[model samples]
Target: MEAMPHDPAKPEFTPLDVPPGGLETPYGILYRPLASGLQILVLFAAFIGGPAFAWVIGQVPGDLSQTARDVLFVPMVAIFFLGYGLWIARLNAIAFHGIGLGLLKALFKLIVFRRKPESVADFIPSRDKLLEMMVRAQQAGSSFAPVGWLVGVIAGLTAMLFDSALHPAKLFLLVGGGCVIWAHLLAWLGRRNWLPFMESE
Candidate 1:
């Protein structure tokens, strides 16, 4: 007897029949390898580009008017922070899933002395499912908590650097206070189980 070739367009078997690395999401085929490479590229670009851009801006000729300089400078600064926010949010998500939550739980147990702190596993459904939750959370805006704080920090630093009238101490204090409030809001959302995107379908 002769054998027939497999046709992916007309899948004859269940999803389990699909091999590893062939998983597809609602968005499209999950190109794990390519995605990983792109993530590395993005991280490298953000970290390296910030200081490089700053240096380039500093080298700008002194002949340009203050208004013209501001036009160029302000947008570059915004771009730097935009990149910083995105990368920071991604890093925070990775840390939260990997070991950050677990470490925080242990630290709380050591300090509170009331009862054994629940494990990260208790809050999270499963390690394997975390990637999906993270993706969804990122889409839903919950994962950008770190981004907001990073932007605040960048804005505060920029103000201090460029505006003599602005008090550096007050700017930093305001940014720090805003970050604290944002952190608490995120914590509250997590406590209420209101992170809709993180919930399993």
Candidate 2:
């Protein structure tokens, strides 16, 4: 009889097949390219649009003092960030039930009490521990970024209020440097999956 090649006694196990469209979560559909593109577009629009709008408004005639413009501009920037965050949360919620409302409530609680839910899984995942961690980390970073900006703005503005003699060039450099640092930090976090909205394939 011809020798036969021995076959393995057991077949190797394969991982559970993911759905063709990838996983769905309460926050949104977790598809790759589309999700990534939408997130980039939204973030870019908000960041750029905020400053541009502020500049346009500042140019309008009113003889508004520079301090007043600075104050107004800071709030406008904050509003852009807030609006974008809420809109994206809502868009994600449309895929799953109550996620938008839940997110808003949770955000309010966190802001008011500096308290987080006992478990993020309660919001992002019912069963997947890994996914829960990913979502929570991203959400935390997202929340922190705006707060950090706000803190910087408030401090800068407070100093300007007390001493209007602060050099404009120095102030511009400080703010610009801080913004550059923030952008780089956010980019790093996004690469590490810390920024959920900025996550890509």
Candidate 3:
């Protein structure tokens, strides 16, 4: 298998006939053309970012109130760090389940059942500037993923604060929700022919 870059100036959506590439590198069909750079970033996040974040947390003033630390780790700054870390760690699959499976279901329903599905537009915009943004992302490599992370964190945090007091469901949404937003962006890319799709000879 080999990774090949296509011209992003003119985008091509993937054809559904042959097997499509894996969403990410580890799955093995499509490789990161800039796999080396991403690998380095992963190493830095694991070795450098992970340990640094832990050390910084450890340095928090021992005399501070429990509530303060809780906010920092629970609903505030930690959420940003976590939102970022989740994407880096690729542990955010739970976020993609809804939209991912829903889109698949919609496609299957239309194809197999020979009935049009309404949920397709709900998962993605039928036509709008968002499509333009998604096209740009198709070319920009995976670096654009954080856009979803940032938005999801802000939305989740706002919900948590408005309700006040952490609830199990809200907290689940807090971390998990961010991944959902990011996953959509990934899905947009995964389906497109703009990627350097690796295929077996």
Pick the lDDT winner. 2
**Residues 1-201 of candidate 3: C-alpha lDDT, one tens digit per residue:** 877876544334553232344233222233223355664554344334323442343233344344433443343234334434543333223223424655677778778999776433545433332333333333333432555456556545644443335563564474346444444444344334232322222
Candidate 2 Cα misplacement greater than 4 A, ranges: 1-34, 56-61, 65-127, 144-201
- Give per-model TM-scores: 0.31, 0.32, 0.24
Task: Report the error of model 1 at residue 55, Å.
Answer: 16
- Model 2, range 1-201, lDDT digits (tens) per residue? 998764444223344344655456664333332365665665575466546655554444345468755654564465445534643553354423435555676788889999886665345433343344334434433343554466456534543443335465455434433433443444344323323452222
Candidate 3: residue pairs that collide? 14-193
Q: Report lDDT (Cα) of residue 173, candidate 2.
A: 39
- Sorting all predicted structures by TM-score, with the top scorer first, yields 2, 1, 3
By TM-score, the better pick of 1 and 3 is: 1
- The clash number for model 1 is 0
**Per-residue lDDT tens digits of candidate 1, residues 98-189?**
56776676677777875554443543445344445444443333333454466556644654454334366764554344443443344333
CA RMSD of each candidate after superposition: 13.8, 14.9, 14.4
* Candidate 3 Cα outliers beyond 4 Å, as residue runs: 1-38, 53-201
Query: Candidate 3: lDDT of 37?
Result: 60
- Candidate 2: pairs in clash: none
Q: Looking at model 2, report the run of 10 residues with the lowest lDDT sum.
A: 192-201
